[model samples]
Target: MTTRTILAAAALALVPALASAECGWEKRINANTCGEGQTFDTATGTCVDQSTS
Candidate 1:
């Protein structure tokens, strides 16, 4: 491919990295203590889990 074509392709490839998408997570724990399996909730900011106790 030509130099310009290659450069353009490279720039387009970086579009996804610049996206707002992020590895979201949530804390699923009780107010007293965090006792649960933390998981990724993309919906929120952090991972969530089932609180116990």
Candidate 2:
């Protein structure tokens, strides 16, 4: 494959990992105290009610 093609493939492979990393704080926060009826919101970096979220 061409260098550009290879680089594109590598970047695609990294997308999911990068996405998960972006939301890693959600996992950590939810693990601590998200509580029922609430979930971690990566955008706000805090727990929010499921209904509003």
Candidate 3:
């Protein structure tokens, strides 16, 4: 009925969505697509250069 009441309702509606958020790297990483001299790094979720002599 009042401004404060409406805002409270809106905030409560958003609580569930905020709580269900996914915290991590991208959904999936296709390591097979890495470059010839590179490899996928799980820790950083990226392709990195492979060490060689």
Candidate 4:
């Protein structure tokens, strides 16, 4: 196959893997529930301890 065609196929193969990868914290809004001693940070969309954050 041509180089361009091979590159296109390789890129397509990476699409699924990239899609499944967790790029960042899961998106949540106003659902501030967190485990004991942890507080949900709205800016980062993650749970952090009160002392640390």
Top of the candidates by lDDT = 3
Q: Write the per-residue lDDT of candidate 1 for residues 1-53, one digit (tens) a residue.
A: 89999999999998887663443344344344533566555555455785576
lDDT of each: 0.62, 0.80, 0.84, 0.78
Ranking by TM-score: 2, 4, 3, 1
lDDT (tens digit, per residue) of candidate 3 on 1-53: 99999999999999987777754434666588788999999899888999897
TM-score of 1: 0.36
**Local lDDT at 17 for model 4:** 84
**Clashes per model (N, Cα, C within 3 A):** 6, 0, 0, 0
Candidate RMSDs in order = 8.0, 7.9, 4.8, 6.3
How well does each candidate superpose onto the true structure, as a TM-score?
0.36, 0.46, 0.42, 0.44
Question: What is candidate 4's lDDT per residue for 1-53, written digit by digit as tens?
Answer: 89999999999999988887765557554445787787778788778777953
Best by TM-score: 2
* Residue-by-residue lDDT tens digits, candidate 2, 1-53: 89999999999999999997887564455435888888788788789878862
Q: Give the higher-TM-score candidate: 1 or 2.
A: 2
Window of ten residues with lowest summed lDDT in model 2: 23-32
> How big is the positional error of residue 25 in model 2, measured in Å on the Cα after superposition?
3.4
